[model samples]
Every structure is written in structure tokens, then in C-alpha cells.
Target chain A: AQTVTQSQPEMSVQEAETVTLSCTYDTSESDYYLFWYKQPPSRQMILVIRQEAYKQQNATENRFSVNFQKAAKSFSLKISDSQLGDAAMYFCAYRSRGNDMRFGAGTRLTVKP
Target chain B: DAMVIQNPRYQVTQFGKPVTLSCSQTLNHNVMYWYQQKSSQAPKLLFHYYDKDFNNEADTPDNFQSRRPNTSFCFLDIRSPGLGDAAMYLCATRAGPQETQYFGPGTRLLVL
Candidate 1:
């Protein structure tokens, strides 16, 4: 069974500062995908970025990036130049070719001005 | 335009009462899914439809049923709402089996 874990329950960052959320997963499959999704107070889940397991290069979208380490099974999200609008619940998800997607508990990000 | 829409953004039902949550997709995706998300918890996949083929999760309760009469819409029916069933219901769609899913705004359900 594949499982994703986000150890941090909550995180805070000063506006314009940077913050990183940690994620790890346990899986045997070599071919897979990882993703980061953000859900604001409106309760809409938005895709932030995605990384393919085979790709050695990390994935980035605008101010969001991921540090994907296949060997260590670590996939962390980095939010740079954070804005007040970035405050939300961020989730790390894993999906293999054969199975349904699995998601972590999620980390609530607070942007303090 | 809302790509994926879940009707009745908020629903309140009494315990043991029957309820139905609706989802419609404008992207015409072949896969449609329903997920349950409790407060501060990750959304859990309850089931999905690949075209007209219905696929239910092994752990899903028998009280929950679904109907997908066509590609653009799917319906989740809870025969008897329970306190444990109170949560937000999310709808998602993918173009195909291996495609990235696009989620709806979600419907918050309150069971009394």
C-alpha cells in the first residue's frame, strides 16, 4: 500500500519570506508522479506543481517548487516570495501508474504580515 | 465558467435521512470521481466512473451509491446520512485514466 505523510500540521511564514513544507511517501513502484495542491478558504483545491518520478529535475510553477528525492522518498514543497494570498492548506499527493492517488494529511500555511 | 461543478455548495441533512450530492463536468472527461474530506484531513476517494463503468472503493460503505447516466454528470446518493458521513464532498475529473484530475469547488455537507 502506498501512503503519504506530511509531518507538519501547521507552518507560518512572514510575507515576502520563504517557507518549505516536507513530505515523504512509501511505495515500491518505480514509475509514479508527485503533486502539490493548495486549498484556500474558499475550499477550492488548486494544483500547484507536479514532478515525475523518473525525472531527476525538480518541478516548479511560478513561486512554488518541489525538491523531489527519489532515493530518499522525500518530496518537499518550497514557496518563495510568499504572499498573503498563499495562506492555505497545502497537500502532497502521490500517484502510481496502477493505483489511485494517495494524499498526505496536509499542512496549513499561515502568512504573517 | 466552472469546469467541474458540484451543486448545492452547502447541504444540511438529518441523520438517517437520504441525501444526494450532484456533480457535473464541462471538460467532458472520461473519468469522474467523488471524495470525502473531513475537517483538516486529506480527501478520501469514495468511488469513480470510467465512462459508464462504476468503480467503488472496497472500504466504501453500502449506504453510499452512485449513478452516472452520461459523461457530463455523476450523482452520489447516500441512502441514510450518518453523523460520520458529514463532510465536504469533492468532485474531480480527468480526461483519461492517466491524466491529471481537475477538482470542483466542493460541497460542504452537514449532518444533524
Candidate 2:
């Protein structure tokens, strides 16, 4: 069974600073995908970024980027220039071809001004 | 905007009462998923629909049922609500093969 793990239950970052949330997954499949999702107080889950396992290059979207290490099974999210609006619950997810997505326990990010 | 819509953003039901949560999508995605998210925890997949084919998770309680009459709408039925069933019900739509994934704002269910 594939499982995603987010070790950090809560994290904090000063506004304009940077923060990284760690994630790891256990999977035997080489062809897969990883994702970072942000859920604000509205409870709306928004896709932050995505990374394909075959791609050696990490995926970056605006101020969010991922350090995807296939060998170590690590997919960590880096939020640069964090803003107050970045305070939310961040969830790391994994999905393989023709399979449903699995989510981690989630990490609550607090962007302090 | 192509989006997923979940009705009754907040719901309060008595224990043993029957409750239904509805989800509609304008994305025309091939798959629709329902997940239960307890406080501070990951969302657990309850079931999903591929086109009109209903797929329920093996661990899903028999008291929970799902109906997808068409492509744009799906309904989750809880025959007997329990306190443990109280959680945020999230509806997500995806273009098959992980092309795109979007989640509804989510409905918070409160069982009394």
C-alpha cells in the first residue's frame, strides 16, 4: 500500500521569510506524481504545485517549489517570501498512474508578521 | 470557471439521522472523489466515480452509499449518522490520469 507522510504537524515562518515542509512517500512504482496542496480557513483545497517522478528537475510555481528526491522518496515543499496569506494547512499528496491520490497527515503553516 | 461545488457548506444532523451531501462539477472531469477529513488529519478516501461506474472503498461503512446519476453530479448518503461520522466532506474532480485536480470548498458535517 502506498502511504504519504508529512512529519511536521505544524510549522511557522516570519513574513517574507522562507519555510520548508517535509514529505515522504513509500511506493514501489517508478511512474508516479507528487503534489502540494494548501487548505485555508475556508477549507478549500488548492493545488500549489506538482512534480512528476520521471522528471529529474524539480517543479516550481511562483513562490512555491518542491525538492523531489526519488531515491530518498522525499518531496519537500519550499515556500519562499512567505506572506501572511500563506498561513494554512499544507498537505502533501501522492498519486500513481490509474490510482487514487493519497494524502499525508498535513502540516499547519503559520506565517507570522 | 470550471469548479466543484458542494452544497450546504455546513451541516448539523442528529445521531442516527439520515443525511445526504451533494457535489456538482462543471469541469466535466472523468473522475469524482469523496473524502472524509477529520480535524487535523489527512482526508480519507471514501469512494469515487469513473463516469457512471460507482467505486466504493473496501473499508467504507455499509451505512454510507453513493450515487452518481450523471456526469456532473454525485451524491453521498449517510443512512445512520454517528458522532464519528462528523467531519469535513470534500468533493474533488480530476481529469483522468492526473491531468488536473480540484476540490470543492468542502462541507463540514456536525453530528449531535
Candidate 3:
């Protein structure tokens, strides 16, 4: 079975500061994809960034970026200059060559003014 | 414009009543997936349709069923909705298994 884990259940960061959310997955397959999705209060989920397993370079989407270490099966998301809008539930997901997409226990990010 | 759409954003159904949620996509994606998300939890995959083919998750409840009559439309039917079935049902579409998924505003199901 494929599983994704988010170690931090909740994280807090002050405005203009930076915070990182940790994620790791267990997969035997060599080719797959990783994604970070954000779900704001009462809103639909949106993609933040995506990282392919074969790429050695990490993925970045503006202020949102990921430090992906495939050898260790670690994919952590970093939010630089955290904004109030960034406060939401961040979910780390894994998708294999198969169609099934699995999500981790999401990390709730709180931004302080 | 949002490519994916789910109708009746909020639905209330009585216990033991059968309910169906509809999803349509204009993206012409080959794979459409239905996910169930409870309060403060991850979205769980119920089933997905790859074009005309239907794929079910091994642990998906037997009561949950899906249909894809055409390339752009999909439906999820709950044979007998229980209290545990109350959750936000999300519809997503992607070109294929290897593509990024685009999601629609989910339908929140309420079981009474």
C-alpha cells in the first residue's frame, strides 16, 4: 500500500517570516509525482506546486517551493515570506504510474500578523 | 473559467435515501475521479473513470458506485447513504494518470 505522511499537524509563522512543512512517502515505484495542494477555509483545493520523481531539481511556484530528496523519500514544502493568505490546510500528495492519488495527514498553517 | 463543475453544491438527504452527485468537465480529460473528504481530513478516493473504463479502489465501500455515460460527464451514486457518508464530495479531472489534476468546487453532502 502507498502512504504519505506529514509530520507536523499544525505550524505557525509570523508574517514576512518563512515556514516549512514536512512530508515523506513510501513507494516502491521509481516513477511518480508529488504535489502540494492548499485548501483554504471553506474553499476548494488548489495546486501550489508539483515535483516529478525523476527530476533532480526541486519545484518552485513563486513563493511556494519544495525541497525534494528522492533518495530519502522526503518532499518538504517551504513558504517564503509567509502571507496571511497562505494560512490554510496544506496537503502533500503522491501519485504513482497508477491512477490512485494518496494524501498525507495535512498540516494546518497559521499566519500571524 | 473553471473547467470542472459539480452541481448542487450542498445536498441534504435522509438516512437510507439514495443520492447522486453529478460532475462534468470541459477539459476533455480521460480520467475523472471522485473523492470523499470529511471534516479536517484528507480526501479519500472512491472511484475513478478512465474514459469508458471504470476503476474502483480496493477498499472503496460497496455502496458507492460511479458511472460515465460520456467522455465529459460522471456520476456518483450512494445506494443507501448513512451518517458516515456525510462529507464533501470532490470531483477532479486529469488528462491521464500522469497529468496534474484539476478539481471542481465540491458538493457537501449532509445525511440526516
Compose the digit string of candidate 3's lDDT tens values, residues B74-93.
99999999999999999999
Estimate every model's Cα lDDT from 0 to 1: 0.93, 0.93, 0.94
Instruction: State the displacement of the C-alpha of residue B75, model 2, in Å, after optimal TM-score superposition.
Output: 0.2
Weakest 10 consecutive residues, lDDT, candidate 2 chain A?
A35-44
Clashing pairs in 2: none
Tens-digit lDDT track for model 1 on B1-112? 8899999999999999999999998998998999999988999999988889889999999999999989999999999999999999999998864668789999999999
lDDT of 1 at B48: 88
Residues A4-109 of candidate 3 have per-residue lDDT tens digits of 9999999999999999999999999899999999999778899999999999999999999999999899999999999999999999999998657889999999
- Candidate 1 residue-wise lDDT at B93: 91
Residue A93, candidate 1: Cα error in Å is: 0.3
**Model 3 regions lying over 4 Å from their true place:** none
How many residue pairs collide in each prediction?
Answer: 0, 0, 0
Candidate DockQ values, in order, are 0.76, 0.86, 0.81
Candidate 3: C-alpha lDDT: 0.94
Using DockQ, rank the candidates from best to worst. Answer: 2, 3, 1
lDDT of 2 by residue, B35-56 (tens): 9988888889999998988888
Please tell me the interface RMSD, in Å, for model 1: 1.3
**Standalone chain B TM-score for every prediction:** 0.97, 0.96, 0.97
